[model samples]
Target: MGERLYLYGIFPAPGPQHLALTGLDNQPIDSHTIEEFTFLFSAAKQERYLASRRNLLGHERVLEAAMQAGFQTLLPLQFGLTTEAWEPVQQELLVPNRDRLKQLFAKLQGRREVSIKVMWEPDQELETLMRENEALRLERDRLQGKQLRMEEVIGIGQAIEQAMEARKLDIIQALRTALNPLAAEVIENEPMTSAMIYNAAYLISWDEEIAFGEQVEALDAQFEERLRIRYNSFTAPYNFSYLAQP
Candidate 1:
């Protein structure tokens, strides 16, 4: 087909015209100034990009570099976003949403996204739940190795799953309570696996990053034996920006 551009991020205009970074296909990253905002993108030889591990990391590399290249603030675009030309991107997406984009950029300035992932052994959580929730424990005991009808087994399984979800929610709330005071915004994304009890991204100001780390350390110390608590303090604020989809 004709030319295509892989969009990465947007920040204020008058940024370095050259990104000093390479993105997909080892292409040089560059900028296209649109109004008061500058859009960062790279030329794509492929018609479109698939979300393979290599391709995804390549996309993120440029976005991360965009922030590191003196502009700490950025509105990270979605992965695999492309346009044949900037005309459509401007006429439809950027120009229409200019004000909101600027406001988001200003709000995101001086802040970075911090990620926290807490995972626990599912078997352990289940055992704890069964012990703490007597009704669930009784249900599990009643259903254990029983020669029951399909519907009866399914019902018992559903009940156990519901109880497990409720327990996960309580733990997520405690995690939020422990970390919310240090964050400008906290977003709880759905846990991807049964072992995941918490997956959240926090917008933390640069000045408070050390305090945030201390808070996370205390939380980890509290649950060191039971849970796997991990945090990364430096990333573009995607969750709290225009890049986030409704």
Candidate 2:
């Protein structure tokens, strides 16, 4: 590849634009229009940009600026997306894929992704389980002084694990039941750690952001003693995109 264009995202226009936003290495961002939508870019020489903090922030700044530019539909390309020239992208990708992309914009317009991360302390839950389950308490008493057998130990560990999973599911179900109706779409991403009970993304419209937040707060208050429900709404809705091409 020769000189490249580090792509940030696409915006459907007739709305305002602020492409003057700086990108990776403080490169001035640029754009190319194909009918109603425009692709945002900047000069690049590297084959691939490393996932450093500065570089990632620069990439995100451009997309977030687009969000602030007053466009209802902003299709944020994934970080590190690049192309050698805009011609092929215009002729091959943009022109050919216009109708499909338009439909995508319709689905994405007026919406933003909201993330919810629910976590709990594993040791605390295990203590609760021990106090509540008589059989588990008996098993603990029986093993207190005897030679610890591998099979007996594994059985107790499995039982505790299953109970923890059930509890996690029940809490998640309650959250979903309350919040899913307010969202246009919901994605349950895999938990990143053992402490995580629910890791989810919701596609919420601008109109429903407040109502959605109130629901989250109520749920958090209800579960505050046992679980911590954290939410983030600042980042772009890239997770819910079909145009976030790498």
Candidate 3:
């Protein structure tokens, strides 16, 4: 019988071996040779094949195994990738997709993905700040006094609205400046609370991950009194489009 190759996502050499421990058909692929690194893939006819949930889990398992093995992988065609035999996998996928795959691998080489979410929790201090703002407090006093006409009351309401808007802007600007050094790409999401501004960003790195985390933590600590933010990091799946094409 001919050898069947189970294709896992592509990666650089030194891939994980225990990946075979997580079976493809609930059976492991054959061992790898000393000279070449091997990944696993299931061989089924492409013409009638479907990417069932079972296949998706299998693929995820394969990638997770690679991560555990200390190797990063990019599954270019995430799901529904198939071949009838090892030769087809080598010829159709490994050969034709070789350049693209290599490019993606190069782009992601030594880089990790980090996510940051900035939120504000309403605290007593912020309320105190609002109360201390002379303009807003004065407006509240004027409205309560019942000494103003309708036009004057409208004016007071407008003044209070403007003051609140300024406060929000001031807080957002502070966070933007504080976060400038830590993020590669920053996206502002809807505010989490009346007091909190949301800034979500993805940071790319290989060596700077530790420094990046420390920086974010420092920011959190520094702003903990008025603003609170947190961050998380994860391994990115391989993608080809992230690279600029030649």
Candidate 4:
């Protein structure tokens, strides 16, 4: 099969720049300039580039290097994007969407994406919910002295599950309210696991990063006993980068 360019992302063209970065198959990372933008990509065979963990991590490594090199407005391409040649990338993607891309780049200048994930200990939250819920308390009391029927046990479990769901919603809303003001854009992602209450991405400007971090620390301190909060702030703006499917 013919070689294709595996795309990582696009950034402002850094004049005479060369990154000591490697991509898929340990290929040296490079770029192709088009007007004011430079596209980062590496050569790979189609089959090898499709969702392989090594290749995917290689893609991220290249983008991370670009970020370190101080390309402020980087737009990450979706994983597995490939084109037969640079001519088609310019003709199909760049030419057709130059103005829109320029606008997006300008808007994203001096900004970066941050991800937040919140998880709670299910047993702890369930115990707290049971204590606060009269129905759950009564149900537990009812079952205390007598043998519980299968349906009764299931009912109590279901009630706890429902309470957990509601609590998750409330916490997610509170998180959005607390963090939205510091972000240029907020993207709520699907929870990755049963214990995950919040999974979101924030596009935050450089000037506001300190404040944003402070707010997160405050929130963590506030909920330290009930929740586990984790964040990553130095990634490329993947959530806001919406290019047409190629």
Best by TM-score: 2
Over 4 Å off, model 4: 1-3, 14-16, 45-47, 143-159, 244-246
lDDT of 4 by residue, 1-246 (tens): 346778888887752257778888777787878888788877765544567787677778788888887776788898888887778878888898888887888878878889899999998887888789988788777788778889988987787778788988888888888999888889999989988888999988887888888888888998878999998877878888886443
Task: Name every residue pair that clashes in candidate 2.
Answer: none
TM-score of each: 0.84, 0.89, 0.55, 0.86
Residue 92 alpha-carbon offset, candidate 1, angstroms: 1.3
Q: Model 2, stretches more than 4 Å misplaced? A: 1-3, 14-18, 148-150, 243-246
At residue 246, candidate 3 shows an lDDT of: 65
lDDT of 1 at 49: 88
lDDT of 2: 0.81
* Weakest ten-residue segment in model 2 by summed lDDT: 13-22
Q: Distance from true position, residue 137, model 1, in Å?
A: 5.8
Higher-TM-score candidate of 1 and 2: 2
| lDDT by residue (tens digit), candidate 3, 150-210 | 8988887687667656766776676667655665545455655565556455545656767
lDDT of 2 by residue, 10-125 (tens): 77864434456777877887777767878888888678999999889888888878777775577778889888977777887787778777887888888888889999999998
Return the lDDT, model 2, position 129. Answer: 75
What is the C-alpha lDDT profile of model 1 across 141-215, one tens digit per residue?
987887999998889889888987897777677778878998888888887887878889999898899998988
Model 4: ten consecutive residues of lowest lDDT:
12-21
Candidate lDDT scores, in order, read: 0.83, 0.81, 0.57, 0.82
* Top candidate (lDDT): 1
Estimate the TM-score for candidate 1: 0.84
* lDDT (C-alpha) at residue 246 in model 4: 30
- Stretches > 4 Å off in candidate 3: 1-17, 20-65, 73-103, 122-126, 144-179, 182-196, 237-246
Residue-pair clashes, model 3: 6
Clash tally, candidates in order: 0, 0, 6, 0
